[model samples]
Target: MPATVFSCRWFALCALLLLGGCQPDQPAPPLDQQLYIWQRQWRPAHEQALSASRADFSTLRVLALQAQPKAGWSRARVDLAQLKADGRPVIAVIRLDGQLPALDLDRARAQISQLLADWRAGGVMPTGVEIDHDSGSARLSGYTDFLIKLRGLLPPSLKLSITALPAWLDSPQLPALLQAVDSSVLQVHAVSNPRLGLFNPGQPRDWAERWGRVSDKAFYLALPAYGIAVLPDDGGAPVVESEVALNRGGERRELLADPQQLATLARQLRAKPPAHLAGLIWFRLPLPGDRRAWSLSTLSAVARGEALASQWQVQLSARDGLYDIRLDNLGNLDRPLPARVELNAEQCDGVDGLSGYTLRQTPKQLIFTRQSSARIAAGGQRALGWARCTRIDQGAWNVYP
Candidate 1:
């Protein structure tokens, strides 16, 4: 062969080796420096959570008067009224510390009637009423009787809601007790303190499933805002803290609402949606003066809604413009808002000839629309979808598509 042609062939061979095709496409550049925005920032990861509510009032049942001292009933009533005035439907639980003044059934009837009348006249009839009797009282008979009579006396318009003993799910009397009320609530506190009945061991999901079997109607799962300290089994009363305390393991531990656990509940509900999964209720309203209060608020937000936006991914061929995304359902339960979708280049290599891209749903199969542009690069992933959903606690529309 001629020297000139041979030299040309050798040069072309060298060019092919220099390109990554010689080395198995260079393993797609080893995915150098990737970014991830988890489902927390995305939409519809969990449906059971309530939506982010701008208005303070939410439709889910709320338990009020839990944090007030026993002596503060009258004051607590007024405070609770204010919450009602704010348009939030509340569950007014009169805390019964096992003290009844001389079996005044007649006076009690009058008081109950007048209270209901006044609340109704003010257009603030509670969603329901409850008695917090967790003291393992043998006097439950009297309390139960009072509620039975009260339910009979009150008009059917008002709902009767109650919290049961930790053992109530298995209590033989629970069926009769449930018969008197519109709905029942099971408080799921970690029994670090066995003093307050057997800490219903097992997961909230399991408890919810079991509770579903006990009641044919909707019910609420009660989650405490604090953690309880289990004392030595000398029959000492257990201590409950709203904040994290140091464990004997010397670990800085706090018992607050765990979002991941909440998410797990959400996932379970999504997977199996209990027949009796009425809703979730957080114990003690307005949050006590503790840092866990923030956790409560965050959990409330998660219950309501959450949204996520992916980092601006680059598609060299993507055109620079707004891309319309048609999601399968538009996430009606999420309540997302209108937002800007901008075009951004790869922070590292702006010269990759505009790699291919698209604007699609998170779970691609859930999308209902196609890309507005032929090739969507940076602008596609930034496109926004509006999603709306009803929150379990706060019945407000949560937007997060």
Candidate 2:
């Protein structure tokens, strides 16, 4: 395999890491475990916690099954039971299809019943179910009916979740489907057509705009675990690989996300997070010996939620009648010192515009040189921030002090 050259900004690397990586045999955490470390670089923390709590190490889920089920219902049953005993949450992803599977309803029910029994007996029920289906105009009545039936059959204690495509933004069936499942995870990675590179990634932004309109309680933000290599003329399946970056010396290397990007994601979740945004989950695991692989170290740091709070604390003191964005420690906030602050009046205070002023520590705020007109008016301030945010969405600016 040829080494990948690092091209985009740090954020782009993080996004790609979530999209295209493919790996096998990474351990799965048990369902009973409190933390589900998706990225492998985080193993140390898991080990640390295991030692401290004396908690039994559990199973970690693997996306082994294709979108379609090839084996018989009995085979699936056996797999489900084994995964249950292993203690990891079993996420059986079924791609969307208008036609039912080869198994009859009776067989499906029997297998499901057995799986549930085994899970309960082993004290390892799934955290929830995950369904990855594309959105289309063909009226998903048949699929919806199946889901409704599945919900009725499952133990009420368990949750039913589905992965949604960007097209859900326009489809009429979404409302009904959202009503059917316990939670819906929007695949924010490839919301647009992969062939033309027509991705606007407006899906997350659209969610933010309508957060107030929707009432779906828990939603997951499903980013890509690997990057798609688009071909000219005709669209083809994207080649999935582990994370890799090339240094100035031109050597292929694994690129791990800096603490800044991780913390930014956490803040996004905290601000306009998906309603009931439980936690972030990195897509598919990395391959063994892949240089750019995301490791357990990154996962552990993110899970602890210290990736952000530990760095860049602000102590507000009025300086020259303007709020100065100070730093307790110069972590990622590197530019210069004693930076002046100012906001762009024209673009400030809106969802779409890159609102608010950012200051560089090079002894001055370079971006806005003139004046600071950014003000919080009482009446308009109610909806200005994420006071009404109830869904996952794009952020207008980085929440930095």
Candidate 3:
């Protein structure tokens, strides 16, 4: 070979090697879809929920039990019998209260051992056990110690994981904590105050990237798929209400995680998935009647990366000299309630909008203006208002012009 040609081929090989080294060692593969069934108690709705969601969600991370501060352990009402029948693997999770000042290690292990034995007797073997503790950054050392000890009881066949918080990224011990578990779930949501909102589109990607750089273990992002209502307590701090209800009477503020924003984030993650990133696990599965959560149709659409859209339809019913107004969502995506609705009416003695809408009476028409950003779920209907009118065509209403 000629000396110049040999030199050129050597330089070309070096350039190719350097370029390959600069990029990710491997291309980001398709993300696996999973869900966190965080409901403290199981209900009949779960049967249908599991069946409907089984097609999209490949695995479930269930809240098997909780370790409360003074309340000790509150075992979840999850039907173990149905887990195997559902035909998806499950990861049993034990949530320890972040408020708890101390870790009761022995009791937790005893409870877990019994829980596992019970599950086995019930003919269900979970894929792994995940520890979900919202410990502060300062406690990462102690938390890692606990996880290391907990690792002993888990068999080699089962993989151990933890529900990690974004705040832990600042802790140096985070790597050790990751080493103690087979994997971790990075939760990107925090409903601190309604004013701040449930999710910020840009921040979670930052967390995923930071975590990927810090840990070698495989991890998944826990995204929000639900909303919460907040009310002020006697103190100034906000009290968040999720699946459970509060008995106190006070004005409430609601914060919802936008479906569109979540869908956009999902696509972005798929485009450039973080290192060791396995998939996404949506927080708390949604039931058909879950007023605070997105509908299954919306979730499925978001999971599959279908286009986000919604079509509103005005449904009017008249009987007994009264007309009722309802809006139906014809599209698969959940949509923000229309801000304005106008309908021509011949004789509307009185009209009023319901819930998030307010009625405005014009000389010849009735108008409804939305008061909030509440969204109507896909394939669902909401009664906007009613009017006692002499005559109005059912198809005369216009949602927005």
Top candidate, metric lDDT: 3
Return the lDDT, model 3, position 298: 88
Task: Quote each prediction's TM-score.
Answer: 0.50, 0.47, 0.86
- Using TM-score as the measure, the top candidate is 3
Error of 1 at 174 (Å): 1.4
How many clashes in each structure? 31, 34, 0
- Per-candidate Cα RMSD to the true structure, in Å, reads 25.0, 23.9, 3.7
Candidate 1 RMSD to the real structure = 25.0
Cα lDDT computed for each candidate against the true fold: 0.44, 0.42, 0.87
Please estimate how well model 1 matches the true structure, expressed as its whole-model Cα lDDT: 0.44
Which of the predicted structures, 1 or 3, would earn the higher TM-score when compared with the native? 3
In model 2, which regions exceed 4 Å deviation?
1-111, 117-123, 135-137, 195-205, 208-212, 224-263, 274-278, 285-292, 302-401
- Using lDDT as the yardstick, the better of models 2 and 3 is 3
Candidate 1 structure quality by residue, lDDT tens digits, 1-401: 99999999999998987874656422211101100011112123112122223232244343333223344233133432343445645455545443434334465456556665666676666766665556344555665677788788767777887776555555666666767788877777653344443233346667677778776876776655333333343345544433344344322223444444554555456455556665655543322233333223444444544431123221222223222222111211211122222222122211111112232223212122322322111112323332221111111122222
RMSD of 2: 23.9
Local lDDT at 207 for model 1: 69
